[model samples]
Target: MIEVIRSALPTRCLYSHVVVSGQTIGAVTRIRYDGPGVMVPRVFGSVFFYQPSQKINLCYGEITESATVNQFAEVIAEDLDALRDLGSGVWADTVVNPVRHVVEVGIQEW
Candidate 1:
């Protein structure tokens, strides 16, 4: 499993590691984030996962900034119409604390 924590400073670049576990041998499948306010944190980033033999893409997306605190953000390959072509069995869970200006992400593989 992969875990990451990042500062939420404006204009700064942040990244988290995507962890995988279980029968599946791939990269991140989905991403979920939460913050103090009702709105999701505004962060721009992407995640990539690869198999043992060859490098491949599993799932990725861009997160826009939030104007309010009531919004939450999540990106699932199966949920997105454009990402249906991507693989399955892996996903990410994240939390953003606006007050603390930090983000935490957890990746799981099934």
Candidate 2:
């Protein structure tokens, strides 16, 4: 089984973590900005991990300001330590995108 926890800054910023059983294996963070025109909602980050074989996958992307999608970019790590290192304060202004965006992170044992 997988458990997920999410937190957001008002409505523009979002952060989430995914845990398998009792171990944290994935996480996501995003920031959104207000623009003059109508923007399509999109996700810009992702995270995935497979414990059975110790496999990991991650991806990141950006969509046009007028485009929208059901999901967003994701990043994954091979282990808990790697995941923590990658997600460490990812929401920090020094690394996060300046534009409106969304991110998703997850981990699983299969």
Q: Estimated TM-score per prediction?
A: 0.18, 0.22
- Candidate 2 residues lying further than 4 Å off, grouped into runs, are 1-13, 16-77, 94-100
lDDT of each: 0.28, 0.32
Clashes of each: 11, 10
lDDT of each residue in 29-104, candidate 1, tens digit only: 2322332333333222222222232221223333332232222233454545434222221223222221222333
C-alpha positional error of residue 57 in candidate 2 after TM-score superposition, expressed in Å:
20
State model 1's lDDT: 0.28
Model 1 is weakest, by summed lDDT over 10 consecutive residues, at 1-10
